[model samples]
Target: MGSFHAMHIETRVTGFIEENCYLVSNPDTQEVVVIDPGDDAADLAARLRGQNFKVVAYLLTHGHVDHISALADLCADFPAPIHIHPADAAWCFTEQNAILGLYPAPRKPDCPLVDATEGMVFELAGASWTVLETPGHTPGCICWKLDAANALFAGDTLFRDSAGRTDLPGGNPRALTQSLRKLAALPDDLRVFSGHGELTTIGREKRENFFMQF
Candidate 1:
């Protein structure tokens, strides 16, 4: 019953980075938000239209290129504000060299960006989500949690059997450990929806994720 009204998170691999673009919507309001419109701007928009959604904003868990390559295109389609963690905002264009130095083209300036903080709560599609500051893969990386749905939009942070690599720029092994600890504390029933890869439950990860102790 609880999952009935829970926000819908749809994933599509678009553009050059192979980043997953998630369309989160409130079934009740038909209002939607796009998370990390990584590359396929047109595809994401088409999908949104097919669902009869009123997209209100584009939220980025971080500013990595693969996660934001199609951000400009998405902003044009939805005409919404672009939100990201302040720490990773600069990465939007700078592509600062770090362990994540290698990958798609260097990031270039394109869209208007906004900063979000931990504990910040916002309403969308008649529901609310808590922003968790879970940085490890990137200094400003985060995960959005919708407690009502027992779901988490974990960017490149925690995965099913493993966690994001800290070998890239702005990554810190110690920080990732701390982030994993925090995620591990969530209820086992919670479903983790990551930026990339298959979705898994917190309980499943806790039991088998070797990188993090459940």
Candidate 2:
């Protein structure tokens, strides 16, 4: 749980993979930002309605099965544009993305798919949002930065004492290293909301995460 001024943030560990889904909402405005609705579409949807959240947008940190498996399902009920990097948008919901036993291919939502370009800005939950394109785990991987909270929504790119593996499809160790360098340059006080595991700070990762050091 976190707060962006009066807005509320709830983290739901969903699906078998335990991907973190973030619901950032401003109760006064009834507007919410849905980040990486990986799995458990039913529960995710229920939680939103239960809280009277009006989803303003669906932001994808990247287009991995564990990160976006529930996107299509959620979009069906909540009509909002989906924002993802063009690189990931190219092949995210195809049959090629299907995992043998872990996940099935995700369907393309009927709603709009906007290219979440680097440095693109947005206003949601009464906070300023910046899109940082960090391609490593996937070509279209991105980290959402919330200036109000000084938080980085790192989706499988940088983790606690670890970084996202580049051995997966479209993974690139070199690109990941470059991305980490970019994050390392940010303010040490910025809170890191990792895609998995416990939360950490940029300063802590710079000292403890070997990948960040490299």
Candidate 3:
């Protein structure tokens, strides 16, 4: 088993929305996985240029354009499968479910796009990630939990003091509420690295997040 001490996480604020893209790595082996590569492909590429980290995969928390804007470009540079919920596949690859006309016709990914489902486990950066289907922000929104590191990559579903907006296409208030509750039920010490804001913890969100009140 890989030790959590060897796992390191780096965050990059990218795109117009300043979305947080995470690079989780195992310093010992220099293996990494990128989450939510929203735009600024050049910057992201530059960060990995001399790092000598072997990118194993790209994980998407959801299909929103802002979280996946750099998909095509990144895949071109580092060939790796993309793990995302099937419900958001179209939104990620094509522009079928895009909202607000914010994205152009996205190019299909050069690498394979795989479905991310609940209970599915995969290894990356010397850590095992378990998928949790926490839909609501979008029909296919999901979260990745690295139990070894006690870290959860919660895309846009749950934020620091607030939750994701349910007014977008396929958004559901009730579903989102349930999702928040599910996340809030996690271990308090679990660190949450969201898509667009500061890092938080399950316990902190439980006590401070208004949406978690449900």
Candidate 4:
């Protein structure tokens, strides 16, 4: 875990796919933002309870089940607001989102879901984050940008050495290309916290990641 911009950020790899669930908190106040609580709900919730931090919200990059499967269960314990792009929010919790012989549908949560729109600014604890719409892997794929931390929560939209796949339901190759163009334009110093895999910086990906090069 690293403390950047006066906040402590911890990543927990969960579930069979080893999805990354991030807990970002202010070191002093302990107010936290739970990003992409994918799976292993019980353990995640328990850890949160153990810390006793105030959960301000749950942020979803898109509504893919692997990235949001534990959202409902975690909300049951934390009861914080959820934020996801409207396009993805439409069917994320439905049976249509389930994977055959693998993951099941995520339960709709008691917490309300706030729309995560393009250019939206989230002022949390003491820092600000801007929402960058990067729809491709899913219709509502997004990346959360925290200028203070110089960090981007890339989710499935981006990864190390590659980017998100555009072969699933609602996938669009052209749209993803456009999204990559947008991300490629950003400064290279921002460190990327992807939905899966290890950490990487925008500079590194821009140089090594073929998708970012395009």
Task: List CA RMSD, all candidates.
Answer: 3.0, 2.0, 1.3, 2.0
Q: Please tell me which predicted candidate would have the highest lDDT against the true structure.
A: 2
The whole-model lDDT of each prediction reads 0.77, 0.89, 0.87, 0.89
Clash count (model 4, backbone only) = 0
Which residue pairs collide, candidate 1? 38-70, 98-169, 99-167, 99-168, 99-169, 100-168, 100-169
State the lDDT of candidate 2 residue by residue for 94-199, as single tens digits.
Answer: 9879989899999898889988889999876677889999999999999999877778999999999999989988999999999999999999999998888888
What lDDT tens digits, residue by residue, belong to model 4 across residues 1-214?
Answer: 2247588789999888899999988877888999999999999988898898889989999998888889888888889889899999999999989987768998999999899999999887577878999999999999998776778999998898889999999999999999988888888888899999989988898899888766
Cα deviation at 101, candidate 2, in Å, is 0.8
**Residue pairs in clash, model 3:** none
After the best TM-score superposition of candidate 3, give how far the Cα of residue 67 lies from its true spot, in angstroms.
0.5
Candidate 4 to truth, TM: 0.96
- What lDDT tens digits, residue by residue, belong to model 1 across residues 8-112? 777887755466778877787788888877776677778887888897777788777778776666666667767789988865566352225434543443556
lDDT measured at residue 47 in model 3 versus the true structure, 0 to 100: 88
Candidate 3 C-alpha lDDT tens digits along 5-111: 77888999997888999999888888889999988988998888779878899999998888888889988998898999998885656656454656665677789
Of models 3 and 4, which has the larger TM-score?
A: 4
What residue pairs are clashing in model 4?
A: none
